[model samples]
Target: MTERPNMETRTILRVIVCDNDIRKIVLPLKPQTVDSLLEQLEEKLGLQYKFTLQFEDPDFNNSLVNLTDIADLPDKPTLKIVSLVTTPTPSTADTEILSVASDDPCHSLRTAWPETFEIPNFPVDVEYRLRQGNLQYMRDQTYLQLSGELKHEILEKLSETIYSYKAYPNKEDFEAVAAALIKKHPCLTQPGSSKGWNGWYDSLRWKMGNYRSKLRRAGCLEVSINGGKRRGQQPQRNVKRPKRFEINFLPNFPDGEDEASMESKRKEMVEEMKKRRLNSALIAQNMNSTFALRRKELIEKEPAVKNTVERWPALFTNGQKSNVNARRTAVLHGLPLLLGEDPTDFYKTCFDCDSNEDMLDTAIGIMTVIPEDSPTVPYSLHLDATTTAIILEGTVVVDNLENVPQAMCLLFGLIYALNLEYPAALKSTFDFLQRVILSLGHKSLKPKIQSLKKSPNAVMFFHG
Candidate 1:
């Protein structure tokens, strides 16, 4: 007779395939080799052809890195069933060579992120906790509440994986990792966010920062140059970090030049803008050449809006593209957050803007609800069914806009371009766009922004 498996560690897992087309019945679980698991799955799920069963590796921010090995097929791990016949992604190829470098994830000579990466297996204790979490999730629907230790393990692994790609991941990149984590394991979804992973997003962001700091201290060249002391002239301002979808967040000064030469080029471009009118292509060319220099002024100098405009007037004037000018706004305005109400509760009314005139009409009510008796900036949008224009300080700043949405977008850029204050009544809504979305303004979040980003029940405040 064959040797009996240990009864103490014995677990019976029943597989439930949600798709009816697959012709599934309950499948019995037997932990052994990868081949055994495949054999069991093929019969029960009625998979007719060759396929790969990829497990979700919690180590690499729940990325589908579990391609092969019995080591990858941990007990109760999350699974991804991919058909072998499908076209492969760049990250899915089974090359013996690693796409990302093993020794130095950062400081690579490559211009872009690696298409594929593989993380090391999780520690035994971390794997045990993950198995327990998956088991509990299977029993009921309770999401895993990660303790401090487990959380740190996931963060550290993810930070290394991200460094293999890019050292400075912007807001969208951070969201992508957090989203993938929850997508792979619904159990790991933090309770707070409607997105279910906003907390993870925040955690990963901080973890990347801390990880970079540690690397910098250990003489990692990629992160070492980014230290505050090494940054140029203005020392008291924010450290230069990636603001948007930047490929090189903090590139060195173009080989042959220094700060004074860049300053000369910037001046030449300012004069060139006047000669070529506001619509010159040279404006962009110069701007591109001086990107590193511009970052220093923006990050180190921390100039005021008017000061920024004085450096380049053409910059603000060139920002009125029709698509970029406007976006679809909500039927609901900022009244919900201003009144301390949960905005998601009004999703029905908020999204239905077909016949809604809330954006135009809401301004009149904003004055009444604000703590101060008087209105700020003479705020309102004028729409007589022909065209809409934003009225700021009793002056129609720009006219012939397509809709209120475009007007709002144009007005927002103007607020920065012209160095204007956000109207007091809608300050929270405006602040949400600046501090939360764009990552502008003070480093420490204000109360309203904190409420929007961190408060579990508080969805983002909007303006429409």
Candidate 2:
């Protein structure tokens, strides 16, 4: 048979003692004398000096009282232990006298109780008390090591406070939130090797911005727009005025008979005009010299022509019909060689193009020979130079195109290849490609064209 639990047994009480170090001790619930408790503390802690104990109030304003009985203390009471000091006293004759006996232990205890304990008659809000305690702890400890649950609770409280007051969390809101969090958990203020208030503030601001964006998306936030300019308000102009020349005119003679003086004045004005013209000419000469010097320096810095041609083959293309036609034929004929096949048919058909229409027909024919899964089809075009120009202009073709999609793809491929070879014409090529795509009314092909235009080859091309 099992023995029944005893209901009459008192629970153990816990007491925290703090001085130079912190310690906790368990005591029997049964009432004990203050002298016995002090003796047990001195013996168990191995303390050699005499000390006084005081209740550790959260407000830190509690008065120290003489301990009479251990039963008088509350459950889990916190206490501060302070070492006692004594000094000698002077007698009536001014002679120093030392007392051999120890001073009374209860002599320094205050007579009045702390205001917090004295206000038992009034009702108190628990939340208010908790906030005050947290603030007091923040003030006393440099860091408050909190558990995960406590940290979460403090963060939740801060979030709620921030949302309740404003839609957008500004610096002031973040400051308030930070202050509250620090008070609740001082460890947040000094997060060792972790993000501090500034990081937290930035995170909070981001969260607020995200929240605002969501509200705006949901049509819950209202935004105001400014109408043009206010009535009767003139728009400000930023016009630059031309410089005016100051000229001195000679005063007329009183008798109106001084032709000699008038002639001399006219001669002086002419000389002044001539001097101004000479100054202008000198300024223009200096500007022209500066420009020439800069141009020469630039030319010296330019890379060698051979290296440039090797790096950018498109720079070598003269853009003439004959040269463009020859290059396009060579590239087409080389495709079969890359595929490990005979290039006789492709070479003959590509080279036989005499007109723009003949070039388009040949280009379309080359596209048919290329396998559907060929990788080269994406990067290179089979179209000759003339065909590319015709496609860019959105001209109506006389030839009945069998595969329009393949032809369009070949056009884009040619553009890509051109950009790789001649980076100097990249912008114009893309502009032309855009116009062709739009004119073709093939919306499905637009994305492909755009993708080709945005490729790294096109992006890094030098328009210069």
Among the numbered candidates, top TM-score falls to 1
Write the residue-wise lDDT of candidate 1 on 1-464 in tens digits.
98766655553332322111112233343546778777777775555446676554556433334357766645555564554532111111111111222355433322344222233347788777777887888899888877798889988988887875678777877887888776666789777688988998889999998998898787654466567664454333345554443444443455455789888878987787676333233343355446557655665567899998889564465231212111123212333344354332111111112333433433211211111322211112111224455555544456555655555567778877878887655566666666655567786876766765653112322210
Residue 147 of model 1 has an lDDT of 79
Alpha-carbon TM-score of each model against the true structure: 0.30, 0.17
* Reference-based lDDT, each prediction: 0.52, 0.35
Any runs in candidate 1 off by more than 4 Å, and if so which? 1-100, 106-121, 229-464
Could you tell me the lDDT of residue 401 within candidate 2?
A: 34
For model 1, state the Cα shift of residue 201 in Å.
1.2
Per-residue error for 103 in candidate 2, Å, reads 63
